[model samples]
Target: MNQVNVFLRQRKDHRRWVALFLALACVVAYATLDRLKYNGQALNHKQMALVCTAHGLVAHEHNDDCYDEDGELRCPLPELELHEHDDSCYEEMAALVCNELESDGHIHDASCYERVRDEEPSCGIENDTHEHSDACYGWHEELICDIPEGEGAHHHGLGCYEIQMALACGLPEITEEHVHTDDCFVEIDMTPDEVEELVEERGPRRTPSWPPCAARTRWSIPPS
Candidate 1:
């Protein structure tokens, strides 16, 4: 009888050990899933939901622009809800924009400026001072800088200007006789035939289809 009791007790202990192992496994799995959902890498619906919720952009908040007609979560605001996950968020200050890398979730801190662009003035200033060089231009009080390609620079046709510096842009004077360039127009050094081909190849987007359906020059600006 005593021998039988020992065997039963040993069996009970074995069962207890199994149960404890299973409980530990359950806890580990739960913790792992939580980490993945909030890791801040490539986000999915559930992960993005958590982020949007924190920012009050989830359902009926101020900027409730989430969800298209298809019920997809689209975060449109510059500072979307990824700050907790990625640990970095894109925020627009008074005149400047800033980002935090933690929102990216380095959970290591990083600089938003370094990750976003090649240098300070991607507006095309090569130096730190951001002076008006060949690539940078001034329109009214605003800076009308050129975006540099390999050899040349181009301005995307963002038609917001105050007309501060005219002579600085010596392509063609805006006067009736000269017309340095028309509104949102740029001068190309290409021959007329080449310019026509480029316009055609660019399709109707660069040049609008409403009035002319044509691009006039090689110096085309990008769309905002």
Candidate 2:
């Protein structure tokens, strides 16, 4: 009888262990399934949403005019809910524009003087008593000079005056004159033919279909 009782207790323990293992397995499976469903839903949402610039041009908050002509004119990506400005963003754009204007030679040489500062040697004329001196400086100044304060020194920085002007003017509408990209209206980076091809490739979402798209697309929201 003692031996039989011991055998029964062992059998019961085995059954309990099996039940526990099965329960654990079921819990793991449920968790996994839940995770998969969540992931799938997220992916679906992303696929349905529209893609836009970092400034959230398509976003409704800041009034940025970003839109989508491609993929069936679907509403702007829902993920881009907020539109805000960034500090360096405008500055970087200004730099890009300045570089472009300087390249075109439409602006004066003084506009890009800062770019080629180190290309020339500086002359020591702090007290140049001549009226014609006018603190004359040029591009490509390699040697450093100790000119008096207020002397014309090449402020070779990231951008030039023309760039600042372009930024101030703001981006133009995307059209035959100014091909638009995901970022901004680009005139210098690509040639005419290349620009056309890029516009076609990026689709209407990037360049937009109208000449006044840029003005319409300006957003008031700041960067997220």
- In lDDT terms, which candidate is top? 2
* TM-score of every model versus the real structure: 0.21, 0.24
Best of the candidates, TM-score: 2
lDDT of 1 by residue, 59-135 (tens): 12223344433454343233212112121222211221112111222221232123222233335546656565434
Task: Supply the global lDDT for candidate 1.
Answer: 0.36
- Writing each residue's lDDT as its tens digit, candidate 2 over 80-183 gives 23324333224322222222222222332343334444333356455557432323545552323334334333432343322231122243322122112445
CA deviation > 4 Å runs, candidate 2: 49-224
> Candidate 2: lDDT of 66?
33
Q: Candidate 1, which segments miss by more than 4 Å at Cα? A: 40-224
lDDT of each: 0.36, 0.41
